[model samples]
Structure formats: structure tokens, C-alpha cells
Target: MSRSSTGDRGQTEPLAALVAVSVMALGLALYGGYLSDVLPGNSDRHVEGATQDRVWNEIQTNGVFDESTDIETVLVAGSTGSNEATDLPEGYNVYVAVTRVGDDGRTEVVDSHYFASDSSPAGDTPSDGVPDAANNATRPVPVRESPGDVEGGRLVVSVWT
Candidate 1:
């Protein structure tokens, strides 16, 4: 017969392991919550609809697109990046992409591609054609596509998720 040194030593090992594991799991969860906002990655910058509206407002204030025109639209991008995260596929939606044509026969497009999931430590790019701080979430460059047979020109903004 084998003899044990401690009265409850046999049961103590499992209990200790359980407690250790529980603490580790809790710590990991808390870290994950913090990392979600602080992490530097594409998913971190996924913009939402309201932010898009704010960007639109900034555009209106900055005079990016001519609101004086009859047509004005704001593109709300759904995809964050190329991991298949959003409910909608990452592709261009013409309705959201805004374009304007002046009486002088000049065609202009204001591309608001990003629509950030969260507003963490943000960034801003400024230049003649660059988006202002308010519109920083959106991509800077504009991609133009012709709308065949459509009366007005088409503004296309490519998306990936």
C-alpha cells in the first residue's frame, strides 16, 4: 500500500491548476479588450456610418463637393479590409460615391472610401487634394469610372474586406 505525506495533497493539485487557468483566462480577456482599441491594424480603423456622415459634413464645410448641384451622395463603405469581416462584400457602391458636374463642364468626384469601426488614436492627412482631419478616416485618392449610358459621370471607390 502507498502512503501519502499530506492529508489533502491528492486533491490540491487539480484545484491549484484550475485556479491558475481561471486567472490566466481572465487576464487574457481583459488584455483582448484593451488591445481591440489600442492595436495597430487594418481592423482597428474600420469606420462606421455616423463617422461617414461626419466626414460628409467636413466635406460640405471644406467645399470638397459642390452641394449647390442637384445631386449629392455619400458613400458608406461596409468592408473594413480583406478578412471578410463585414456583412456586405467589399466592393464599390456607386450610390455612396459622390460626384459633381459644374456648369463649366468640369467633372469632379469626392471619394470617401473609409466609413473607421472605432475612433481610437486617429490620424489626419492634409494637402490640396488630401482629406482634412475630419475626413482622415477616408482614403485620400479618388477613383473615377464612367457610367455608360448614364446621364451623369460615375465615381467609383474600390473596397476590400
Candidate 2:
């Protein structure tokens, strides 16, 4: 009887240890997934959304589309290589276009600007068309033509890795 009791205790200890190890491993795996934002509702898309918000905020705060501001001049100069400096983030390709819907319901680009990064030739605006990046963020900026005349337009900022 004594020998049997001792043997049972030894087996129980090993079983308990095995269970503890498995639980610890599971906990570590969950933590790692959370850290990497692999869980539901926390993903790379969230980061991309945040990037879009940041770009929109920058455009609004800088008055990029306001006709009264010099941001258009700065962007145009940057795009033309006359001024290499730009307010856009590094490695980002920016396109700004102000379009108007005519009486015939046709949209026309009243004004436009483009900028490309030095390292990315593909970021350059296509000769006959717009930038051809699939992964891009766009924000509609309210264009104030005068003190009270506001129009609707979009500012697109595309980023590539």
C-alpha cells in the first residue's frame, strides 16, 4: 500500500507540470498575437487607416487646397524640381486635383499638382495619366475659392514600400 501511494504521487507531479507548461505556452502565443496585431479588429488595415487620417489632417491643417494659401505654389515648385523640398512624407507620392462639375455634369480638372519621391521612379506622374499605384489614400479637401465660396475637391496621397 505505501509503495502504491508513493508511485501515484510521483505520477501526479509530472502530470501537473505538463499541464502547466501547456497553459504557459498558450498564454505566450496569445500575447505574441496581440503584440503583432493579428487578432480580430486589430490589423494592418487599422494602421493604414491611421495613415490616411494623418495625411488628411496634414492637408487640412496646411490649407493645401485653399486658393489664398501658397501651399499650391510650394507643391508645384517641388514637383517641377525648382524646389526639392516638400511638406509630404518621405517615400510618398502626392497628387492634388481640383475638379469642377460643369453644367453638363462633366468633371474638369481646374487645377492639379504631382510630386514623386527621389528613390521611386514609378512614383512619378505618368505622362498621359495619373499615378498608377493601387495602394493609395485619398481625402476630399474643401476648396475655398474666396472668403465664402467653398468647393469640393480631393487630395490624394499614395505611399509605397
Candidate 3:
């Protein structure tokens, strides 16, 4: 009887281990599938927010479109990559624009910088002056024309992947 009981215990130990391993593997497979389906959608939002943050930081740091500064000079340099302070993610395009609002609240573009990409259609400009398909994030920054001048406008940043 003692010999038989000892043999049964040994077999049960291996069986329990096998069942545990199988359950763990199934759980892992399900989790991986869930991530594959969800990650792509969340990634776009992440990129949008990140791009907005980068553009805002650059404008604040470089004083772009600020009063007493040459808008043309700053815009030219920024468009040519000389004034780019942030490193964007792969396959992303950024368009920065400065707009001024009139007394009637009508806004006009003052200066703009567009970084075009050859590979993605998202970087291409449409005939209607809008992106055909892309994710965009825009932020309006108040410009300072002069000391205590409320004649400021907005700085728009559009990021697309």
C-alpha cells in the first residue's frame, strides 16, 4: 500500500505542472492578441499629443512670431530646418503656421513652415489646402507684438503621420 501511494503522488505532481503551464500559455496568447488590436489606435493619439507638445516648446524657446522679431527671417530659418529644435518620430510631418486676427476676429496667415515628406501621402498638400488623410494636432499660441500689446494671434502646429 505504501509503495502504491508514493507512486501516485509522483504522477500527480507532474500532471499538476502540465496543467498550470497550459493555462499560463493560453492566458499569454489572449493578452497578446488584445494588445495587437488596441495598440495601433492608441498610438495615433499618443503621436498627436507628443507633436503638439514639441511644437509648443519650440515656439516658446525660439520666440517665433513674437513682436520686435523679424517674422520672415524666423519663418524662413524654421522652414529650412535651421531652427528645428525637436526631433519628430519616423514618418511624421509637421506644419507650423502663424496667424494674426483682425479687429473683426478674422484671422490671416502671417507665416508658415511646412515640412514635406516624400513617402507618405499625409505630407502632401491637397488642392483644397487640407490634408486628405492624416492625424493632425493643432495648438493656438498667443503672439506678443510689443510690450503689453494685445495684438497677438495664434501659432498653429499640425502633425500628421
Candidate 4:
């Protein structure tokens, strides 16, 4: 008899819970599904940059493989080679292409190595990966031909999932 004044108190609890749950479900659906499409995925860019840095580091650790017969691994042993994939991330396909910078400021593909996630081979072009568009990083380096001979080159690393 004393608490009969506000009999709607019990009804408000369930109503409030239903509203809250509906709002949460709607938010989950929107954010989890549609929000990613609206947002530019920076993870791919970050991974591409990181992989580029790793390849450059490996090159520095164990120098670039030249076409000379007396090629040598400069710092680290068995890390960098001409036709092998380095310790890249498992889910990415990487394309490492080296270009010679000529005196006229042009570039020529000197050496290229592909690392595919599926353990397959990439085609003659870069568009053969899972994603046609890519996040790429390029760095200038020196190409060593023989003892006391060096030229300008650039390393281009392209990463795609």
C-alpha cells in the first residue's frame, strides 16, 4: 500500500535494459561492419613501411647480391640473397625490386625477388598479387659490382596482402 504510488518503477527497468541492449547491438553492427569501409586502413601502410625497413636492414646487415662471381655476404651470414625471401611476415606477399640509377636519372630493373604468402610465384608484373594497389617504399642504395666499383641504385619494396 505504501509503494503503490509509483507502480511504473518495475516496468522502467526492463524498458531501459531493452533500449540499452538495442543501442549496443546497433553500435556493434555499425562499427564492426560498416565503419571499416569508411575508414582508411593504416595497418597496411604500417606493415608495408615496417617490411621495407626490415628489407633495408637485412640488406645492410648482409650486403646486396651482385652479378659478380665473387659475391660476398657483408655482415650477416645467410640473411640476404638474390633469389630468396627474407624473414618477412607470414600473411604478406612482398616484392623487392632493385633498380640501377643511371647518370641520366633514369631507372632500370637490375634485380628483383618475390615473396608470396602462398609459396607461389608472382607474374612478370606487380599487379598479379592479391591486391592490385599497394603501399610501397623506396630507398637509395649503392650497388657494388666488383672490388672498388660502386654505382647508385634504389630498392623498391612493395607489400600486398
Candidate 5:
């Protein structure tokens, strides 16, 4: 006398589960695109190829810290699409630190670190705060080589996305 069958109920449960899983997968994909800078207005703050090549060239050609006024510390900054973006993320992969260049033109990483956001002490921003340390208690990066025949005395910094 029953119009509904137990087999139909079992099939319905599996179908419902499958639909829920599919929806969850789609939501995760959308979120990943949004976070990976693939979505519209997403800021792709990656290291420029020219910048990296230039720094490497300087190190290879001029030789690391060959002069007395060689670069001591470098502060790498990262942000979302040049300041024209909205709701910038609170943290990025940019780093800040001091490095010592040897006569062989090799850069030796010394103190590498990043700064957290001003809002959350436990959070990080898309910018590097090494420059602020120049005026603060942070000590001037040790000058291993003096400026003698060096063309540019700026530090060589490399950033990764």
C-alpha cells in the first residue's frame, strides 16, 4: 500500500550529498582565484624581472661591496597594484633585511624579516618597514666594503611573489 519505496530514499540521499560536494568544490575554486590575483582588481605584486636582473648584474659586474660605501641593508616592499586597488590584503610575502656583499660579488643574507600590519600586531601588511628602522633603534647595516670604484652604492634586493 505504500507509494514510496525505500530504494528511492537511499538514491535521494546520495544525490543530495553529491550536490553539496559539488557546490563546495566550486566555492573553493572561486576563492582560490580571488586569492591568487587572477580575479578582477586582484593585485599581483610580484618582483619585476628587470629589477632582479639589474641587481644581479650590479653584484656580478661591480663585485659585492667593492667600495667602502657599499650597500649594507635592503628593504623590499610589496603592495597590491600600485595603491589603486581596494581592500588590500593585510599580509604579503615581501621581506626586509641587511646583507653583506663580499669582494667576490656574492650577497650574504644577514638579517631577513618582514613587518606586521599596524592594525593587528599579529598580522602582516603588504609593505616592508625596514626603512623605518633606519631612524629607530635598528642599527645601520654593517658596511663591509668602502666606496671606492663603485658606481651605485645601493643595496641589491630580490623579491619573490
Candidate 6:
């Protein structure tokens, strides 16, 4: 009869270790998947409808001064700006615009205020417009046909997340 060596006595250890390693790898993979479900996604989110209404109200109030909405003088000089629009919801972009409505049903953009976006420069505007703002709010307001002439107009405010 031949005697077995000490190394040969533990010959099955490598196979047992291989099985343990496989089980550990599987556990880690399952834990990673579970974390993905529990974590929030890293992408743009859809903004709430009420948020748009709140921003609209703010712009409508901003467009008027002294209980008058004849913003022609303010629009003409291109000096109208505000920090309030930029102080709204976090991770959102804001755009406020004033447009003139003609008797012929045509609309002309008279003024635009942009704020709180990646592309907005110095909290005023991006020049190209508010990025990622798909849904914008519109409301009727009094606009100046001229410096002193009152007429119909529209106020538009857009927000994006």
C-alpha cells in the first residue's frame, strides 16, 4: 500500500475555493442591480404643472409697473432685467417674453428675459433662448402699441428641468 502525501490530502481545496469565489461574485452582481433600482436616475426630469403656473404669475406681475402693463418703453430701451426669475425652482430654466398682438392676428416679439439655465449668460439670457423648455405659459396682458398707446399683448413664461 502507498501512503498519500500531505499536499495530496488537501487536493479538493482548490475546487472548494473556486465554488466560494463564484458565489461571492454572484452576490456582488445581485447587490449592484438592487442599488440601481433604489437609486434615482441621472437624467432630466419632467417639471410639475403647478410650477409653470407659479412662474407665469411671477412674470405677469413683473411685466407690470404702477398697475400698468404698457411695457413698450421698457422693452424699447432693452434695459428690463430681474433677479427674481433666476431665483425660482432649482434645476430649472426660465424665459419671460412680451409679444404684441396685431389686429390682423399676427404676433411680434417685443421683449425677452431669460434666466436660470446652463446656457443663460449672466442670468439675463442665452440669446438663442431657454434651453430644454418644452412647455411654456402664455397669458394676455396690456401692451403698448407705442410709448403711450395701450393695446393687447401676450406674456409668455417658460420653465425647464
The candidate that wins on TM-score is: 3
**Model 2: lowest-lDDT 10 consecutive positions:** 117-126
For model 4, residues 1-161, the per-residue Cα lDDT tens digits are 46567757657577899999999999999887776666665344457767767766665524653534121132113445444344566677777776886677787776666666642345434565435576687888777767667787787878777
Q: What is the Å distance of residue 4 in model 2 from its true position?
A: 17
Per-residue CA lDDT of model 3 for 34-137, tens digit only, reads 89778765554557567556555545534544644433344335554544333444466656666788767888675555654331223223334547565666
> Which segments of candidate 3 are over 4 A away from where they belong?
1-17, 36-46, 61-92, 118-128, 150-154
The best candidate in terms of lDDT: 4
- Return the lDDT, model 6, position 60: 47
Instruction: Compose the digit string of candidate 1's lDDT tens values, residues 19-94.
Output: 9999999999999998887875536334334334444443342323443322222222323434222332223121
- Candidate 2 TM-score over all chains jointly: 0.53
Q: Which of 2 and 5 is the better model by TM-score?
A: 2
- Candidate 6 positional error at 87, Å: 5.2
TM-score for every candidate vs. truth? 0.30, 0.53, 0.55, 0.52, 0.31, 0.43
Which portions of model 1 show Cα errors greater than 4 Å?
Answer: 1-12, 39-97, 100-131, 136-148, 151-161
lDDT of each: 0.38, 0.54, 0.57, 0.62, 0.38, 0.56
**Model 3, C-alpha of 106: deviation from truth (Å):** 2.4
Instruction: Tell me which of candidates 4 and 6 scores higher on lDDT.
Output: 4
> Per-residue CA lDDT of candidate 6, range 1-161, in tens?
99766766545687899999999999999999888777754223434345445544443443542223322333323333632333345666666567776677888776665655442323345457666645666777776444566777766767775
Taking every candidate in turn, the Cα RMSD to the unseen true structure, in Å, is 13.7, 6.3, 6.3, 7.6, 13.1, 11.8
Residue-level error in angstroms, candidate 5, position 32? 1.2
